[model samples]
Target: MISQTLTLELKQVLGALLFGSRRPISVADMRRVLLEVAEQNGDVGGRFAQTSA
Candidate 1:
């Protein structure tokens, strides 16, 4: 699970990105963004698809 601190940070960034878009953020887009953030934060070790660590 993403720490509370990390989740807040990601939400802030995601909010900014979403607000900048012409349309609402889609589920796929959000998932892609979150997965990217998870990789950067080294929080993907728990998921089989993200076992790159």
Candidate 2:
């Protein structure tokens, strides 16, 4: 299961992504961003790996 703090963090990141986007974001787009973030910083704390969309 995802921790509460991680859930909040994910929401914040996703919100920021959507706010900055020029068009509607897709699930595949979101997953790509999430995976990229996970690969780059290792700070998403494996949340994507732990849970499903």
Candidate with maximal lDDT: 2
The TM-score between candidate 2 and the true structure equals: 0.67
> What tens digits encode model 2's per-residue C-alpha lDDT throughout 1-53?
87564333677778888999999999889888877666665655466544458
Range of the 10 consecutive residues with the lowest summed lDDT in candidate 2? 43-52
Collision count of model 2: 0
Off by over 4 Å in 1: 1-8, 43-53
Candidate maximizing TM-score = 2
Off by over 4 Å in 2: 1-8, 43-45
lDDT (Cα, tens digit) per residue for candidate 1, span 3-37: 56433364465687788889888767766766766
lDDT of each: 0.58, 0.72
Model 2: C-alpha RMSD to truth?
A: 6.8
